[model samples]
Target: MITRFEELDWQSTPIGDLTLRRRTEPAVGQEIYEVKLGDEYLMSSLFTVAEEELADLGLAAVAGDGLSVLVGGLGLGYTAVAVLQDARVTSLTVIDRLGAVIGWHERNLLPVSAELVDDARTTLVEDDFFAVMRSAPVEGRGGYSAILLDVDHSPRHQLDPTHADLYDAAGLRALDRHLAAEGIFALWSDDPPDDDFMIELNAVFDDAVAHVVDFENAVTGGMSSNTVYVARSRGTGSASLDSTPAHADKDA
Candidate 1:
């Protein structure tokens, strides 16, 4: 596929270096601009079903209240912005390994994100998502109401191969400890994994299910899709294998 992104105004900020590219596809019939931090593709001005579905998944778990949430990635700050829109979300913490991505959101992407970077409910932590989640304190009472991760495409096709551990059994067991009672965990992947991942999730979480969302190429109107793994905490918040959708945390 020829990814033609025009070089717009570029800026090097705190989070990472950002380059703006506008894709004008005659076949798709519309011009789309996208932000890229370093080499990673963030999002475009046209489509965002993956990010939206993730937020929707988080909202489905618990009712509106003072809830705490942990977002694994901060690509263009779209998901973070969406999460802060809910009155129920009192504290929204985001962990991203790349400082430039967070900084790009703080500077350029915020306008595209509707100024969610300035929201007080948001906290930006520059660290590895897994490392931070495995160590950060819950600040007493009411642990994380949800853990939403948009780390990679899917367990089978990871954008960052090193993150494969998160899809493994051990990493998920560690993730289970951080969830509060009635908390939900949402993971975004590009493609569905094999049966091994499903088996592992079944062995770990109380509830887990695959939520597939369709996407169309803005240029060609071609169809594409992504999957979200939704898993809810089980048993007195200790993490036990419950029903498939309730506890499992792997893609379809």
Candidate 2:
């Protein structure tokens, strides 16, 4: 038996106050973990199918070994852990804007923290994800094979209003420079697929797709879904808006 509710940790971040808590569900009789930012809930352990799927569907689209991955958010560490499941992934760098959130995992406060911190390939970078995205490649590594993002809620609904620009055409094009030619970019969204966002992606990348992942909602006792958008970068030096599909083999 567990306590009905407990607040494990709390911190004030640039965006808002973040709180990590554990609670017992009366109906299910199970303990659930939750992360809250201000008045909004960032994540809940009860529904992580979408988060896991964001990594699965994104990596599935990549076609090579020794793949290097960059995860934009470290929420609950589900996506980062999922990225490590593949033997092909030789390196993974997780970037988060809030150092406090990263500290939670580093302090072993979260369930998946131990595994993530112990993984030899995992690197936790305490920095602004978007700022890094716009900057030059780190240590002149050229670019990453896959960039998995779950920082914001969705393309349309962002926790921070400034993040909305990242979903735009110009912002995406700038982000593409950080990807290896044929590198894949995948994003997790709390909302359903937005056709307008797909159009913006298509305008920037060689190929793009939106995957709808379904899962059972424990609270509502019904089905719920989230969207994952995956897109392949147009190789460096290639025309930005070329209609021809960029072949990964040719680029490699």
Candidate 3:
């Protein structure tokens, strides 16, 4: 259909460029934003199989009832939007470092993500996720059912400089505090972390599980996929999501 990027309120940044594209299909009836580095298309809010899985895993953690979710990034708002779909989510607080991202949703992206905004369960926070986590210790932001963080590429491969610290011990511990007794912390990575990362996560949480998802972009025809790391408050596997399927290890 030869879409023009200019009409879509293109946002330019040093890391990459974002185009807020209108949903060309009537059935979809939503806007989708795409991130591109130079000419290389990175990702979009459309067809987010892995993001949805994060929500599913989170809902399963707290038995899917009266849930409060904290999402760390607003990339296309896919994860936040999916979490809003579940009626169990009583409140969802989303944090994004970039004000431009939040603006896109409130300005051009709302038609596609309107349901999430109208749900009365969503709160958008434009601030550093790290600062937000640090404040959690005394801010009484505790008791989240799920804390889903889809930041940068992943801890192993960071698309931004600030992302590296997220995988460190301090970051994980901060995440731990905001979670309820049985809450689940779900993290999405562009690639698998080294063995040491897994060991570190296991040490922080009572029980931790990793799911490697094989994603082939139907639109761009890319072969790369990613993994999602899930951990619970207690070491006894309190998160209700099924442990990594036996086959996932081989895939990892």
Question: Which candidate has the highest lDDT of all?
Answer: 2
Instruction: Give the higher-TM-score candidate: 2 or 3.
Output: 2
In candidate 3, stretches whose alpha carbon ends up further than 4 angstroms from where it belongs are: 1-7, 12-32, 37-42, 108-111, 136-138, 220-224, 235-252
lDDT of 2 by residue, 1-252 (tens): 545999999888778899999998865789888999999988998888999998999999999999999999998999999999999999999988888888989999888899999999999988777765544454566378999999888999888886777798877876787788899999999888999999999998877998999998878889999999999997752334233232232112
Indicate which candidate wins on TM-score: 2
Which ranges of candidate 2 are over 4 A from the true structure?
A: 1-3, 237-252
**Pairs clashing in candidate 2?**
none
Position 92, candidate 3: lDDT: 94
Q: Residue by residue across 37-91, what tens digits does model 1's lDDT show?
A: 6787766656678787888786777655888988888876667877887888889
Clashing pairs in 3: 206-235
Q: After superposition, how far is residue 251 of candidate 1 from its true place, in Å?
A: 31
- How many clashing pairs per prediction, in order? 20, 0, 1
Across 16-64, the per-residue lDDT of candidate 3 in tens digits comes to: 7655554442334445556554576556656587877777775665665
* Candidate with the larger lDDT of 1 and 2: 2
Q: Candidate 3's C-alpha lDDT?
A: 0.69
